[model samples]
Target: MRPWLRIKGVFVYLRAFFSFVLGGLAAGCATVGPDYAGPPATPLPAAFTRAGEPPEAPRVAAWWNQLGDPTLASLVERAFAANPSLAAAQARLLHVRDMSRTERANQMPRGGADLFYAHARLPSMSGGAEDGSQLPSRLDLYNVGFDATWEIDLFGGQRRAVEAAGASVQAAEANLADAQVSLAAEVAQLYVDLRGCQRREALNDDAIARQQRGLDLARRRREAGTASDLDLARLQGQLEATRADTGQLAAELDGYRNALAVLLGLPPGTLDDELAKPAPIPLPPTAVAVGDPTALLKNRPDIRAAERTLAARTAQIGQAQAARFPRLTLMGLIGIGGSHLSDLAHLDDFTALAAPRLRWNFLDFGRNAANVDKAEDMRNEAVSHYRAAVLAALRDAEDALARFRQRRVTVATLARAVEAARRAADLTRERERAGTTTMMDLLDAERTRISTEQRLASAETALTGDFVSLQKALGLGWAESPRH
Candidate 1:
């Protein structure tokens, strides 16, 4: 046939082949297996059992700022930026997003350029001389070409794979958000504990000073032959005990600082100089805005991650089902080559090839059916996991709410006790000055006052810690922007 006629025939064949492929693609829109219809509905209460008159609006994203502590806010922001765990989660999100892109690209044609060189030697085909020695034939060929391949998604297998990949990317993003929420809460809790320790240390200092004064008074009375040796010994022991308590507080303060440093991605003790000075514990606002349980389901990162995972598993069912059908692949190559390397550049001396393939593992001893069944099982497992996540999130929110409410009551009661103790100490001091009570009575009153104050400080710190937990349970620390 003439070269021009051959080229025209090839064009006609390619056109018909592409038309058939397009028709097949149009018909392949019917995906196998069940289509995803979103997550199953989980029964949720309109409001949390422990949340009383919570606000309708969702909690703020940066809930740490509600504590009104600049230092804590700064620490939380630092953790978001530098915490190793959060950074790792962010990297995972990027990795999953790239994988999703790869899956989507699978549905499109792939083409690449190729350059190849070859050298070969073969023995003579005819009989050699009687001596059995002959020069071998030599051949060399060079080629430059462009090749393309496309796997037609005739049963939506690739489509389902891409869908699953996209869902997995979403799950990774939610995981990153969860990491951020956890990190922020940890930073705040440590900071509160550090300050609370400092407050207790200060109380110990005051107690130590008071005990020293009582000891001095006891010494004067003993010299005056009015106080017993036992009284002086007891005062000295109390002074040393107060001093020992300060030592414990110092160690605990160091621990809190170290933990906060680690949460901010710094070595332990890195925050020592910054947090050594005493400060009041960061206090939460009187009324925290905890949204309803429905909002909690939508806002919690773990719940979102679980739901996305379920979606990915559901898509996998279609991917496995589609594998039971045939797959069609089209491949084409166009190149110029000859025995001489120079011919590689000669456009007129060219070769062209087009091949179409169909593949089906129709007789695999039920392997494809088993794969489909396994995918369905995975999807069912994911459904259970998603439901479990929903319930766990609800439980966390309710438990945090209850703790926060009860902590507030405890703090108030301690505050009242502290006031009562202070009044009693004042009365006893006046009595001692009037000579109506001994120095021992005055020392006892001061000890009770200091102890009550210590209890109040500890309760206040716990209340703030509970507030941090509440914010964490509400999934309030992650930003609204897409993390990955």
Candidate 2:
């Protein structure tokens, strides 16, 4: 054959080979196993049954800001930036993203350049030494080459692997978001508790002061023969009890401060000076907007992560099924080397090689079949888990809503009780000044007012805490700045 004709024939052969490879890939695009349509839908109510108000769109992202407390907002932001758990979640997300990228790279051709040098000595047979003299007893070899390999995804196994990896990456991201939601809620709750404790402590201080004054008066009256020992003892006992309650409040305040500091990734007592001054509990808006159940499914990170996990598991089924088929790999190498070291300089003396390898474990004692069965089982488990997640999310949101709504009612009732007690105390004080009521009557009325006020403070704190829980259930706080 003519040289030009030979070159043309080679080009034609190369073209045909590539066309076959491409056609195979195009046909193999139909992946094995059942395709993932989407997450299975779970039945949900149109609106939360316990939602007191009309359903409206919830401002779930950055919901902490809606509480109208800048300090709580700042703490949440700080926690997001520094909390150890959130940092760990972000690291997990990064790891999965890198793994996903690696899976994608597996779909492309792989090439490497290699250089090898070696010296070897061969032993001669004593009886055949004269005949062995024709062969060299020692040799030095040097090789430099570029080699390439590409595994054709003829059954879309590699493609399914890549798909699974991508879904895993999304799941990791959702996990990170869930961490953020939890962290923000934790910080806000701790902050509210701290403020509530401070308020209680302040009230306790007033009670202790008033009880001391009353005790002093009772002692003076006893000394003057106007009061009995029983009266003085009762006054002293009340003072002691109030002082004991103050100690408990102090401990609670310290604990809340320490917890808040830790959530911000700071050492215990770090926030003491900053939070030493008492502040009011952050209150929720009058009309909380909680979107429908469908919105909850989309917003909640746990649900999203679960759904992604199901998708990844579904892809794994296809991957396992594909494994039962054959794999095609194309390998090629080009190099130059010779017996003499100087021969390495002769570029024209280089050798070239190419091969296509096909492998199939046609009989592995049903191992591939077992793998496919396991994969299908895993997918089914994932489906169950995803449904469980959806149900759990809905239950959580509804529970939070119930608690918040009831807490609001409790707070309102307590506010009314506090108001009535204050009015009674005012009336008692006036009656005492008019000589119609005794000092004890005024003292008792004042105590009642303070006690009711304390209860109101506690109820207010719980309401705010419930509000935080509701926001967390709605998957708020992950949409803030510096998102991963």
Against the hidden reference, what TM-scores do the models get? 0.93, 0.93
- Summarize candidate 1's per-residue lDDT along 343-437 as a digit string, tens digits: 96566566777788899889999999999999999999999999999988889998999999999999999999999999999999899999999
The TM-score, computed over Cα atoms with residue i paired to residue i, of candidate 1 is 0.93
All models, RMSD in angstroms: 3.7, 3.5
RMSD of 1: 3.7
lDDT of 1: 0.87
Clashes of 2: 0
- In model 1, which regions exceed 4 Å deviation? 1-20, 125-136, 481-484
Candidate 2 lowest-lDDT run of ten: 3-12
Best candidate per lDDT, number? 1
For candidate 2, write residues 408-482 as lDDT tens digits. Answer: 989999999999999999999899899897777888998899999999999999999998999898887786323
